[model samples]
Target: MRIRFKLDGQDVEVDVKHTDTLLKVLKDRIGVGSVHFGCGEGSCGACMVLINGRLRYSCLTLAGYVDGKEVTTVAALARDGELTEIQRAFLENDAAQCGYCTPGMILTAKVLLEKNPSPSDEELFDALAGNLCRCTGYIPIINAIKSVSRR
Candidate 1:
Protein backbone atom coordinates (compact mmCIF):
# COMPACT_ATOMS: atom_id res chain seq x y z
CA MET A 1 0.00 0.00 0.00
CA ARG A 2 1.06 3.57 -0.62
CA ILE A 3 1.32 5.65 2.53
CA ARG A 4 1.68 9.37 2.94
CA PHE A 5 3.07 11.13 6.01
CA LYS A 6 5.01 14.15 7.03
CA LEU A 7 8.53 13.04 7.86
CA ASP A 8 10.96 15.39 9.52
CA GLY A 9 8.73 18.30 8.45
CA GLN A 10 8.52 17.20 4.82
CA ASP A 11 5.78 15.33 3.07
CA VAL A 12 6.66 11.80 2.03
CA GLU A 13 4.92 9.04 0.13
CA VAL A 14 6.07 5.48 -0.09
CA ASP A 15 4.88 2.04 -1.00
CA VAL A 16 5.15 -0.50 1.77
CA LYS A 17 4.14 -4.07 2.43
CA HIS A 18 1.78 -5.14 5.18
CA THR A 19 4.62 -6.70 7.12
CA ASP A 20 6.96 -3.78 6.74
CA THR A 21 7.78 -2.14 10.04
CA LEU A 22 8.16 1.65 10.23
CA LEU A 23 11.79 1.17 11.20
CA LYS A 24 12.55 -0.69 7.97
CA VAL A 25 10.71 1.84 5.87
CA LEU A 26 12.51 4.78 7.45
CA LYS A 27 15.96 3.19 7.39
CA ASP A 28 15.79 1.23 4.16
CA ARG A 29 13.44 3.03 1.81
CA ILE A 30 13.62 6.55 3.20
CA GLY A 31 17.24 6.39 4.26
CA VAL A 32 16.61 7.95 7.65
CA GLY A 33 19.71 7.23 9.74
CA SER A 34 18.52 8.43 13.12
CA VAL A 35 15.92 5.72 13.67
CA HIS A 36 17.96 2.71 14.71
CA PHE A 37 16.94 -0.95 14.58
CA GLY A 38 17.47 -2.37 18.04
CA CYS A 39 15.43 -5.13 19.63
CA GLY A 40 12.98 -5.09 16.70
CA GLU A 41 10.46 -6.18 19.30
CA GLY A 42 9.70 -2.76 20.86
CA SER A 43 11.48 -3.84 24.03
CA CYS A 44 14.22 -1.29 23.35
CA GLY A 45 13.54 2.35 22.59
CA ALA A 46 16.15 2.60 19.85
CA CYS A 47 13.43 2.84 17.24
CA MET A 48 11.30 5.46 18.94
CA VAL A 49 9.60 8.14 16.81
CA LEU A 50 7.02 10.80 17.44
CA ILE A 51 3.84 10.07 15.56
CA ASN A 52 1.46 13.02 15.83
CA GLY A 53 3.43 14.23 18.85
CA ARG A 54 3.29 10.93 20.76
CA LEU A 55 6.17 8.54 21.14
CA ARG A 56 5.82 5.17 19.43
CA TYR A 57 8.13 2.28 18.78
CA SER A 58 8.88 2.30 15.10
CA CYS A 59 9.84 -1.36 15.19
CA LEU A 60 6.37 -2.32 16.33
CA THR A 61 4.47 0.25 14.29
CA LEU A 62 3.49 -0.93 10.84
CA ALA A 63 4.44 1.38 8.00
CA GLY A 64 0.84 1.80 6.89
CA TYR A 65 -0.26 2.78 10.38
CA VAL A 66 1.23 6.23 9.88
CA ASP A 67 -0.31 6.76 6.48
CA GLY A 68 -1.36 10.32 7.22
CA LYS A 69 0.36 11.08 10.47
CA GLU A 70 3.26 13.34 11.37
CA VAL A 71 6.53 11.61 12.19
CA THR A 72 9.31 13.47 13.94
CA THR A 73 12.85 12.20 14.30
CA VAL A 74 15.98 13.65 15.84
CA ALA A 75 16.97 15.05 12.47
CA ALA A 76 14.10 17.50 12.68
CA LEU A 77 15.21 18.90 16.02
CA ALA A 78 18.15 20.63 14.43
CA ARG A 79 18.06 23.46 11.93
CA ASP A 80 20.58 24.82 9.41
CA GLY A 81 23.65 23.19 10.93
CA GLU A 82 22.66 24.22 14.47
CA LEU A 83 21.63 21.70 17.10
CA THR A 84 18.45 21.99 19.07
CA GLU A 85 18.65 22.99 22.72
CA ILE A 86 18.19 19.37 23.78
CA GLN A 87 20.89 18.24 21.39
CA ARG A 88 23.23 20.84 22.74
CA ALA A 89 22.46 19.77 26.26
CA PHE A 90 23.20 16.17 25.35
CA LEU A 91 26.49 17.17 23.87
CA GLU A 92 27.40 19.26 26.88
CA ASN A 93 26.61 16.37 29.21
CA ASP A 94 28.06 13.62 26.99
CA ALA A 95 24.76 11.86 27.00
CA ALA A 96 25.72 9.36 24.34
CA GLN A 97 28.13 6.46 24.25
CA CYS A 98 28.25 3.94 21.41
CA GLY A 99 25.50 6.28 20.13
CA TYR A 100 23.05 3.45 19.50
CA CYS A 101 20.39 4.80 21.81
CA THR A 102 21.03 8.53 21.60
CA PRO A 103 18.36 9.34 19.08
CA GLY A 104 15.62 7.51 20.91
CA MET A 105 16.80 8.80 24.24
CA ILE A 106 16.86 12.34 22.96
CA LEU A 107 13.42 12.03 21.43
CA THR A 108 12.05 10.53 24.62
CA ALA A 109 13.69 13.24 26.67
CA LYS A 110 12.29 15.91 24.42
CA VAL A 111 8.79 14.57 24.90
CA LEU A 112 9.23 14.34 28.61
CA LEU A 113 10.42 17.90 28.88
CA GLU A 114 7.70 19.14 26.61
CA LYS A 115 4.98 17.56 28.68
CA ASN A 116 6.49 18.52 31.99
CA PRO A 117 9.23 21.07 31.90
CA SER A 118 10.18 20.21 35.45
CA PRO A 119 10.09 16.46 35.68
CA SER A 120 11.39 14.91 38.87
CA ASP A 121 14.31 12.53 38.73
CA GLU A 122 11.94 9.63 39.16
CA GLU A 123 9.79 10.91 36.33
CA LEU A 124 12.87 11.25 34.21
CA PHE A 125 13.79 7.67 34.99
CA ASP A 126 10.31 6.51 34.17
CA ALA A 127 10.34 8.39 30.88
CA LEU A 128 13.57 6.71 29.86
CA ALA A 129 12.71 3.28 31.22
CA GLY A 130 12.07 1.93 27.74
CA ASN A 131 15.48 2.92 26.42
CA LEU A 132 18.43 0.80 27.44
CA CYS A 133 21.93 2.20 27.24
CA ARG A 134 24.53 -0.40 28.11
CA CYS A 135 27.28 2.18 27.90
CA THR A 136 27.62 5.57 29.61
CA GLY A 137 25.09 4.37 32.13
CA TYR A 138 22.36 7.05 32.42
CA ILE A 139 23.74 9.80 34.58
CA PRO A 140 24.81 11.97 31.69
CA ILE A 141 21.55 11.34 29.90
CA ILE A 142 19.62 12.34 32.98
CA ASN A 143 21.74 15.44 33.40
CA ALA A 144 21.18 16.41 29.80
CA ILE A 145 17.42 16.24 30.17
CA LYS A 146 17.55 18.10 33.41
CA SER A 147 19.71 20.80 31.92
CA VAL A 148 17.15 21.52 29.24
CA SER A 149 14.46 22.05 31.81
CA ARG A 150 16.69 24.20 33.95
CA ARG A 151 17.19 26.69 31.19
Candidate 2:
Protein backbone atom coordinates (compact mmCIF):
# COMPACT_ATOMS: atom_id res chain seq x y z
CA MET A 1 0.00 0.00 0.00
CA ARG A 2 1.05 3.58 -0.62
CA ILE A 3 0.91 5.88 2.40
CA ARG A 4 1.29 9.64 2.47
CA PHE A 5 1.72 11.71 5.58
CA LYS A 6 3.47 14.71 7.03
CA LEU A 7 6.71 13.73 8.74
CA ASP A 8 8.47 16.29 10.88
CA GLY A 9 6.73 19.10 8.97
CA GLN A 10 7.57 17.60 5.59
CA ASP A 11 5.16 15.81 3.31
CA VAL A 12 6.29 12.22 2.70
CA GLU A 13 4.94 9.41 0.59
CA VAL A 14 6.10 5.83 0.60
CA ASP A 15 4.95 2.40 -0.45
CA VAL A 16 4.67 -0.12 2.30
CA LYS A 17 2.98 -3.38 3.11
CA HIS A 18 -0.11 -3.33 5.29
CA THR A 19 1.64 -5.48 7.85
CA ASP A 20 4.58 -3.11 8.12
CA THR A 21 4.86 -1.35 11.45
CA LEU A 22 5.45 2.35 11.49
CA LEU A 23 8.64 1.82 13.45
CA LYS A 24 10.15 -0.28 10.72
CA VAL A 25 9.21 2.21 8.05
CA LEU A 26 10.46 5.19 10.01
CA LYS A 27 13.89 3.77 10.73
CA ASP A 28 14.44 1.70 7.61
CA ARG A 29 12.60 3.37 4.78
CA ILE A 30 12.41 6.96 5.98
CA GLY A 31 15.81 6.88 7.71
CA VAL A 32 14.65 8.60 10.90
CA GLY A 33 17.27 8.05 13.56
CA SER A 34 15.49 9.13 16.72
CA VAL A 35 12.83 6.43 16.82
CA HIS A 36 14.54 3.41 18.29
CA PHE A 37 13.49 -0.23 18.39
CA GLY A 38 13.74 -1.30 21.97
CA CYS A 39 10.80 -3.62 22.45
CA GLY A 40 8.91 -4.26 19.27
CA GLU A 41 5.86 -5.32 21.29
CA GLY A 42 5.25 -1.73 22.37
CA SER A 43 5.83 -2.59 26.02
CA CYS A 44 8.80 -0.23 25.97
CA GLY A 45 8.24 3.38 24.91
CA ALA A 46 11.40 3.37 22.83
CA CYS A 47 9.55 3.69 19.54
CA MET A 48 7.47 6.67 20.60
CA VAL A 49 6.47 9.42 18.20
CA LEU A 50 3.84 12.13 18.19
CA ILE A 51 1.01 11.30 15.85
CA ASN A 52 -1.49 14.09 15.36
CA GLY A 53 -0.25 15.77 18.56
CA ARG A 54 -0.55 12.62 20.70
CA LEU A 55 2.15 10.15 21.63
CA ARG A 56 1.97 6.78 19.85
CA TYR A 57 4.23 3.73 19.89
CA SER A 58 5.49 3.35 16.38
CA CYS A 59 6.18 -0.34 16.98
CA LEU A 60 2.48 -1.01 17.39
CA THR A 61 1.18 1.47 14.85
CA LEU A 62 0.59 0.07 11.40
CA ALA A 63 1.95 2.06 8.51
CA GLY A 64 -1.50 2.29 6.94
CA TYR A 65 -2.89 3.84 10.09
CA VAL A 66 -0.61 6.83 9.69
CA ASP A 67 -1.74 7.66 6.21
CA GLY A 68 -2.50 11.37 6.03
CA LYS A 69 -1.56 11.85 9.70
CA GLU A 70 1.20 14.04 11.05
CA VAL A 71 4.17 12.50 12.84
CA THR A 72 6.86 14.18 14.92
CA THR A 73 9.96 12.68 16.48
CA VAL A 74 12.82 13.93 18.63
CA ALA A 75 14.59 14.83 15.41
CA ALA A 76 12.03 17.53 14.86
CA LEU A 77 12.57 18.99 18.32
CA ALA A 78 15.83 20.60 17.22
CA ARG A 79 16.18 23.24 14.53
CA ASP A 80 19.21 24.47 12.56
CA GLY A 81 21.63 22.28 14.54
CA GLU A 82 20.59 24.02 17.75
CA LEU A 83 19.34 22.05 20.69
CA THR A 84 15.71 22.54 21.62
CA GLU A 85 14.81 23.84 25.04
CA ILE A 86 13.90 20.37 26.23
CA GLN A 87 16.99 18.84 24.70
CA ARG A 88 19.14 21.46 26.38
CA ALA A 89 17.38 20.81 29.63
CA PHE A 90 18.10 17.13 29.32
CA LEU A 91 21.74 17.85 28.74
CA GLU A 92 22.04 20.35 31.60
CA ASN A 93 20.28 17.96 33.94
CA ASP A 94 22.33 14.95 32.82
CA ALA A 95 19.16 13.03 32.14
CA ALA A 96 20.72 10.53 29.75
CA GLN A 97 22.97 7.69 30.77
CA CYS A 98 23.38 5.07 28.08
CA GLY A 99 21.35 7.36 25.82
CA TYR A 100 19.40 4.53 24.24
CA CYS A 101 16.12 5.88 25.56
CA THR A 102 16.89 9.58 25.42
CA PRO A 103 15.05 10.24 22.18
CA GLY A 104 11.84 8.62 23.34
CA MET A 105 12.08 10.18 26.75
CA ILE A 106 12.60 13.62 25.28
CA LEU A 107 9.62 13.27 22.95
CA THR A 108 7.43 12.14 25.82
CA ALA A 109 8.55 15.10 27.87
CA LYS A 110 7.86 17.39 24.95
CA VAL A 111 4.24 16.26 24.74
CA LEU A 112 3.77 16.54 28.47
CA LEU A 113 5.12 20.09 28.53
CA GLU A 114 2.98 21.09 25.58
CA LYS A 115 -0.16 20.01 27.41
CA ASN A 116 0.87 21.39 30.78
CA PRO A 117 3.62 23.93 30.75
CA SER A 118 4.10 23.44 34.46
CA PRO A 119 3.35 19.91 35.50
CA SER A 120 3.55 18.89 39.12
CA ASP A 121 6.03 16.24 40.16
CA GLU A 122 3.37 13.57 40.36
CA GLU A 123 1.88 14.63 37.04
CA LEU A 124 5.31 14.53 35.48
CA PHE A 125 5.87 11.02 36.79
CA ASP A 126 2.56 9.85 35.42
CA ALA A 127 3.28 11.39 32.02
CA LEU A 128 6.62 9.57 31.83
CA ALA A 129 5.41 6.26 33.20
CA GLY A 130 5.51 4.64 29.79
CA ASN A 131 9.08 5.66 29.03
CA LEU A 132 11.61 3.44 30.77
CA CYS A 133 15.21 4.43 31.31
CA ARG A 134 17.55 2.01 33.00
CA CYS A 135 20.47 4.40 33.26
CA THR A 136 19.62 7.75 34.90
CA GLY A 137 17.26 6.46 37.63
CA TYR A 138 14.63 8.99 36.46
CA ILE A 139 15.49 11.81 38.89
CA PRO A 140 17.59 13.55 36.32
CA ILE A 141 14.93 12.93 33.69
CA ILE A 142 12.28 14.50 35.87
CA ASN A 143 14.57 17.38 36.68
CA ALA A 144 15.18 17.90 32.98
CA ILE A 145 11.48 18.20 32.29
CA LYS A 146 11.03 20.47 35.28
CA SER A 147 13.82 22.71 34.10
CA VAL A 148 12.06 23.19 30.80
CA SER A 149 8.96 24.32 32.67
CA ARG A 150 11.05 26.96 34.40
CA ARG A 151 11.96 28.43 31.02
Candidate 3:
Protein backbone atom coordinates (compact mmCIF):
# COMPACT_ATOMS: atom_id res chain seq x y z
CA MET A 1 0.00 0.00 0.00
CA ARG A 2 1.07 3.56 -0.57
CA ILE A 3 1.65 5.63 2.56
CA ARG A 4 2.23 9.32 3.12
CA PHE A 5 4.17 10.75 6.02
CA LYS A 6 6.48 13.56 6.94
CA LEU A 7 10.05 12.35 7.07
CA ASP A 8 12.60 14.56 8.71
CA GLY A 9 10.81 17.84 7.92
CA GLN A 10 9.51 17.17 4.43
CA ASP A 11 6.47 15.35 3.18
CA VAL A 12 7.07 11.88 1.77
CA GLU A 13 4.91 9.36 -0.03
CA VAL A 14 6.06 5.82 -0.62
CA ASP A 15 4.81 2.34 -1.30
CA VAL A 16 5.27 -0.27 1.36
CA LYS A 17 4.30 -3.88 1.83
CA HIS A 18 2.31 -5.09 4.82
CA THR A 19 5.42 -6.65 6.25
CA ASP A 20 7.60 -3.63 5.59
CA THR A 21 8.90 -2.08 8.77
CA LEU A 22 9.42 1.65 9.22
CA LEU A 23 13.13 1.02 9.49
CA LYS A 24 13.20 -0.81 6.15
CA VAL A 25 11.12 1.84 4.44
CA LEU A 26 13.23 4.67 5.82
CA LYS A 27 16.55 3.13 4.85
CA ASP A 28 15.68 1.34 1.63
CA ARG A 29 12.86 3.36 0.15
CA ILE A 30 13.54 6.82 1.51
CA GLY A 31 17.32 6.47 1.87
CA VAL A 32 17.60 7.71 5.44
CA GLY A 33 21.16 6.61 6.11
CA SER A 34 21.39 7.87 9.68
CA VAL A 35 18.90 5.52 11.36
CA HIS A 36 20.76 2.22 11.62
CA PHE A 37 19.42 -1.31 12.00
CA GLY A 38 20.69 -3.06 15.07
CA CYS A 39 18.60 -5.76 16.73
CA GLY A 40 15.69 -5.42 14.30
CA GLU A 41 13.60 -6.58 17.23
CA GLY A 42 13.15 -3.32 19.14
CA SER A 43 15.51 -4.59 21.82
CA CYS A 44 18.10 -2.10 20.65
CA GLY A 45 17.23 1.51 19.84
CA ALA A 46 19.32 1.87 16.72
CA CYS A 47 16.10 2.23 14.78
CA MET A 48 14.50 4.74 17.14
CA VAL A 49 12.72 7.79 15.74
CA LEU A 50 10.56 10.58 17.02
CA ILE A 51 7.04 10.10 15.78
CA ASN A 52 5.06 13.20 16.69
CA GLY A 53 7.68 14.02 19.32
CA ARG A 54 7.46 10.63 20.99
CA LEU A 55 10.27 8.10 20.90
CA ARG A 56 9.37 4.98 18.94
CA TYR A 57 11.21 1.92 17.69
CA SER A 58 10.98 1.94 13.94
CA CYS A 59 11.98 -1.70 13.69
CA LEU A 60 8.77 -2.67 15.40
CA THR A 61 6.61 -0.01 13.74
CA LEU A 62 4.87 -0.83 10.51
CA ALA A 63 5.55 1.46 7.63
CA GLY A 64 1.85 2.21 7.38
CA TYR A 65 1.76 3.16 11.05
CA VAL A 66 3.71 6.27 10.19
CA ASP A 67 1.30 7.30 7.47
CA GLY A 68 0.31 10.95 7.93
CA LYS A 69 2.49 11.20 11.00
CA GLU A 70 5.47 13.47 11.48
CA VAL A 71 8.72 11.57 11.78
CA THR A 72 11.78 13.39 13.03
CA THR A 73 15.28 12.03 12.73
CA VAL A 74 18.63 13.36 13.83
CA ALA A 75 19.01 15.01 10.45
CA ALA A 76 16.15 17.40 11.20
CA LEU A 77 17.42 18.50 14.60
CA ALA A 78 20.26 20.50 13.10
CA ARG A 79 17.95 22.77 11.11
CA ASP A 80 20.01 24.00 8.13
CA GLY A 81 23.36 22.29 8.67
CA GLU A 82 24.23 23.96 11.96
CA LEU A 83 24.69 21.39 14.71
CA THR A 84 22.17 21.40 17.56
CA GLU A 85 23.44 21.90 21.07
CA ILE A 86 22.52 18.30 21.86
CA GLN A 87 24.64 17.06 18.96
CA ARG A 88 27.46 19.29 20.06
CA ALA A 89 27.17 17.99 23.61
CA PHE A 90 27.46 14.46 22.32
CA LEU A 91 30.50 15.45 20.35
CA GLU A 92 32.06 17.22 23.32
CA ASN A 93 31.51 14.21 25.54
CA ASP A 94 32.61 11.71 22.89
CA ALA A 95 29.37 9.83 23.39
CA ALA A 96 29.31 8.47 19.87
CA GLN A 97 31.53 5.43 20.08
CA CYS A 98 30.91 3.48 16.89
CA GLY A 99 28.27 5.90 15.58
CA TYR A 100 25.77 3.06 15.32
CA CYS A 101 23.52 4.20 18.16
CA THR A 102 24.29 7.90 17.97
CA PRO A 103 21.27 8.88 15.91
CA GLY A 104 18.81 7.17 18.19
CA MET A 105 20.64 8.33 21.26
CA ILE A 106 20.67 11.90 20.09
CA LEU A 107 17.01 11.87 19.07
CA THR A 108 15.85 10.33 22.32
CA ALA A 109 18.07 12.60 24.35
CA LYS A 110 16.51 15.58 22.65
CA VAL A 111 13.07 14.33 23.64
CA LEU A 112 14.15 13.71 27.21
CA LEU A 113 15.57 17.17 27.61
CA GLU A 114 12.56 18.71 25.97
CA LYS A 115 10.19 17.01 28.34
CA ASN A 116 12.26 17.64 31.42
CA PRO A 117 14.95 20.25 31.16
CA SER A 118 16.22 19.31 34.61
CA PRO A 119 16.11 15.56 34.55
CA SER A 120 17.98 13.69 37.21
CA ASP A 121 20.74 11.27 36.43
CA GLU A 122 18.41 8.42 37.26
CA GLU A 123 15.88 9.75 34.83
CA LEU A 124 18.52 9.98 32.18
CA PHE A 125 19.45 6.35 32.79
CA ASP A 126 15.82 5.32 32.64
CA ALA A 127 15.11 7.33 29.53
CA LEU A 128 17.95 5.65 27.66
CA ALA A 129 17.38 2.17 28.96
CA GLY A 130 16.16 0.98 25.59
CA ASN A 131 19.31 2.02 23.74
CA LEU A 132 22.30 -0.27 24.11
CA CYS A 133 25.75 1.05 23.38
CA ARG A 134 28.34 -1.70 23.71
CA CYS A 135 31.16 0.47 22.42
CA THR A 136 31.29 3.55 24.66
CA GLY A 137 29.42 2.15 27.61
CA TYR A 138 26.69 4.33 29.20
CA ILE A 139 28.74 6.86 31.09
CA PRO A 140 29.65 9.10 28.20
CA ILE A 141 26.17 8.93 26.79
CA ILE A 142 24.57 9.83 30.10
CA ASN A 143 27.10 12.59 30.61
CA ALA A 144 26.30 14.00 27.22
CA ILE A 145 22.62 14.06 28.00
CA LYS A 146 23.26 15.55 31.39
CA SER A 147 25.51 18.23 30.00
CA VAL A 148 22.80 19.41 27.67
CA SER A 149 20.09 19.41 30.31
CA ARG A 150 19.37 22.30 32.65
CA ARG A 151 20.46 20.21 35.61
Candidate 4:
Protein backbone atom coordinates (compact mmCIF):
# COMPACT_ATOMS: atom_id res chain seq x y z
CA MET A 1 0.00 0.00 0.00
CA ARG A 2 1.10 3.54 -0.69
CA ILE A 3 1.12 5.95 2.21
CA ARG A 4 1.46 9.72 2.16
CA PHE A 5 2.31 12.01 5.04
CA LYS A 6 4.22 15.10 6.00
CA LEU A 7 7.54 14.02 7.50
CA ASP A 8 9.69 16.52 9.28
CA GLY A 9 8.63 19.47 7.10
CA GLN A 10 8.32 17.74 3.76
CA ASP A 11 5.56 15.82 2.10
CA VAL A 12 6.53 12.20 1.62
CA GLU A 13 4.97 9.28 -0.20
CA VAL A 14 6.13 5.71 0.06
CA ASP A 15 4.94 2.17 -0.49
CA VAL A 16 4.57 0.15 2.67
CA LYS A 17 3.10 -3.14 3.74
CA HIS A 18 0.04 -3.11 5.98
CA THR A 19 1.92 -4.75 8.80
CA ASP A 20 4.88 -2.36 8.62
CA THR A 21 5.33 -0.35 11.77
CA LEU A 22 6.03 3.36 11.60
CA LEU A 23 9.46 2.78 13.10
CA LYS A 24 10.39 0.35 10.34
CA VAL A 25 9.04 2.60 7.60
CA LEU A 26 10.82 5.65 8.97
CA LYS A 27 14.15 3.88 9.47
CA ASP A 28 14.20 1.38 6.63
CA ARG A 29 12.46 3.17 3.77
CA ILE A 30 12.67 6.85 4.70
CA GLY A 31 16.21 6.65 6.04
CA VAL A 32 15.21 8.18 9.39
CA GLY A 33 17.59 6.45 11.76
CA SER A 34 16.83 8.54 14.82
CA VAL A 35 13.61 6.68 15.65
CA HIS A 36 15.17 3.63 17.30
CA PHE A 37 13.54 0.27 17.91
CA GLY A 38 14.24 -0.70 21.50
CA CYS A 39 11.59 -3.13 22.72
CA GLY A 40 9.39 -3.28 19.58
CA GLU A 41 6.55 -3.13 22.07
CA GLY A 42 5.15 0.29 23.05
CA SER A 43 6.48 -0.01 26.59
CA CYS A 44 9.98 1.33 25.90
CA GLY A 45 8.89 4.55 24.15
CA ALA A 46 12.16 4.56 22.21
CA CYS A 47 10.23 4.73 18.98
CA MET A 48 8.11 7.74 19.86
CA VAL A 49 7.12 10.26 17.21
CA LEU A 50 4.63 13.07 16.76
CA ILE A 51 1.73 12.36 14.47
CA ASN A 52 -0.40 15.42 13.77
CA GLY A 53 1.19 17.02 16.82
CA ARG A 54 0.34 14.13 19.18
CA LEU A 55 2.92 11.76 20.58
CA ARG A 56 2.63 8.16 19.44
CA TYR A 57 4.87 5.14 19.78
CA SER A 58 6.13 4.41 16.31
CA CYS A 59 6.97 0.84 17.19
CA LEU A 60 3.30 0.00 17.51
CA THR A 61 1.84 2.37 14.93
CA LEU A 62 1.20 0.82 11.57
CA ALA A 63 2.41 2.79 8.60
CA GLY A 64 -1.06 2.82 7.06
CA TYR A 65 -2.49 4.38 10.18
CA VAL A 66 -0.45 7.52 9.63
CA ASP A 67 -1.37 8.14 6.06
CA GLY A 68 -2.13 11.80 5.39
CA LYS A 69 -0.96 12.81 8.84
CA GLU A 70 1.93 14.99 9.87
CA VAL A 71 4.84 13.07 11.36
CA THR A 72 7.64 14.79 13.21
CA THR A 73 10.74 13.16 14.61
CA VAL A 74 13.68 14.43 16.61
CA ALA A 75 15.26 15.51 13.35
CA ALA A 76 12.55 18.12 12.93
CA LEU A 77 13.31 19.77 16.26
CA ALA A 78 16.63 21.01 14.94
CA ARG A 79 16.47 23.74 12.35
CA ASP A 80 19.33 25.24 10.34
CA GLY A 81 21.89 23.22 12.29
CA GLU A 82 20.67 24.69 15.59
CA LEU A 83 19.00 22.67 18.31
CA THR A 84 15.63 23.46 19.83
CA GLU A 85 15.39 24.90 23.33
CA ILE A 86 14.49 21.51 24.80
CA GLN A 87 17.49 19.92 23.13
CA ARG A 88 19.71 22.65 24.48
CA ALA A 89 18.27 22.23 27.96
CA PHE A 90 18.86 18.49 27.82
CA LEU A 91 22.48 19.10 26.93
CA GLU A 92 22.94 21.79 29.58
CA ASN A 93 21.35 19.55 32.21
CA ASP A 94 23.25 16.47 31.04
CA ALA A 95 20.07 14.50 30.55
CA ALA A 96 21.44 11.93 28.14
CA GLN A 97 23.77 9.07 28.90
CA CYS A 98 23.46 6.21 26.42
CA GLY A 99 21.50 8.64 24.20
CA TYR A 100 19.14 5.97 22.89
CA CYS A 101 16.13 7.54 24.62
CA THR A 102 16.97 11.19 24.07
CA PRO A 103 15.00 11.58 20.89
CA GLY A 104 11.78 10.22 22.33
CA MET A 105 12.29 12.13 25.55
CA ILE A 106 12.89 15.39 23.73
CA LEU A 107 9.94 14.87 21.44
CA THR A 108 7.68 14.01 24.33
CA ALA A 109 8.85 17.10 26.17
CA LYS A 110 8.31 19.13 23.05
CA VAL A 111 4.66 18.19 22.97
CA LEU A 112 4.29 18.92 26.65
CA LEU A 113 5.91 22.33 26.51
CA GLU A 114 3.99 23.29 23.45
CA LYS A 115 0.73 22.64 25.19
CA ASN A 116 1.55 23.83 28.69
CA PRO A 117 4.45 26.26 28.17
CA SER A 118 4.97 26.20 31.91
CA PRO A 119 4.28 22.79 33.35
CA SER A 120 4.66 21.80 36.97
CA ASP A 121 7.07 19.10 38.10
CA GLU A 122 4.28 16.58 38.29
CA GLU A 123 3.06 17.51 34.82
CA LEU A 124 6.55 17.10 33.49
CA PHE A 125 6.81 13.70 35.10
CA ASP A 126 3.47 12.69 33.67
CA ALA A 127 4.47 13.85 30.21
CA LEU A 128 7.65 11.79 30.34
CA ALA A 129 6.18 8.80 32.11
CA GLY A 130 5.87 6.78 28.94
CA ASN A 131 9.49 7.23 27.94
CA LEU A 132 12.22 5.21 29.65
CA CYS A 133 15.87 6.11 29.94
CA ARG A 134 18.13 3.39 31.26
CA CYS A 135 20.81 5.96 31.83
CA THR A 136 20.94 9.45 33.46
CA GLY A 137 18.86 8.28 36.45
CA TYR A 138 16.00 10.59 35.33
CA ILE A 139 16.92 13.49 37.63
CA PRO A 140 18.83 15.29 34.93
CA ILE A 141 16.04 14.52 32.52
CA ILE A 142 13.48 16.01 34.88
CA ASN A 143 15.77 18.96 35.49
CA ALA A 144 16.11 19.50 31.80
CA ILE A 145 12.34 19.67 31.41
CA LYS A 146 12.11 22.05 34.32
CA SER A 147 14.79 24.26 32.86
CA VAL A 148 12.98 24.54 29.58
CA SER A 149 9.64 25.03 31.24
CA ARG A 150 10.97 27.83 33.39
CA ARG A 151 12.21 29.72 30.38
**Candidate 1 residue-wise lDDT, 20-132, digit = tens:** 99999999999999899999998989999999999999999999999999999988999899998999999999888899999999999889988999998888899999999
lDDT of 3 by residue, 81-124 (tens): 88999999998998886899899999889888888999987888
Give the Cα error of residue 96 in candidate 4, in Å: 0.4
What TM-score would every model get versus the actual structure?
Answer: 0.95, 0.93, 0.96, 0.93
**Candidate 4 backbone collisions, by pair:** none
Clashes by residue pair, model 2: none
Report the candidate with higher lDDT, 1 versus 3. 1
Q: Which candidate gets the maximum lDDT versus the true structure?
A: 1
The TM-score between candidate 1 and the true structure equals 0.95
lDDT of each: 0.93, 0.90, 0.90, 0.90
Ten-residue segment with the worst summed lDDT in candidate 1? 142-151
For model 4, state the Cα shift of residue 60 in Å: 1.3
Query: What residue runs in model 3 are displaced by over 4 Å at the alpha carbon?
Result: none
For model 3, name the residue pairs that clash: none
How many clashes (backbone atoms < 3 Å, residues ≥3 apart in a chain or on different chains) does model 4 have? 0
TM-score of 2: 0.93
lDDT of 3 at 97: 69
For candidate 4, write residues 67-139 as lDDT tens digits. 9999999988888999989999999999999999999999998889889999988888888889998874599
* Model 4 spans with C-alpha error above 4 angstroms: none
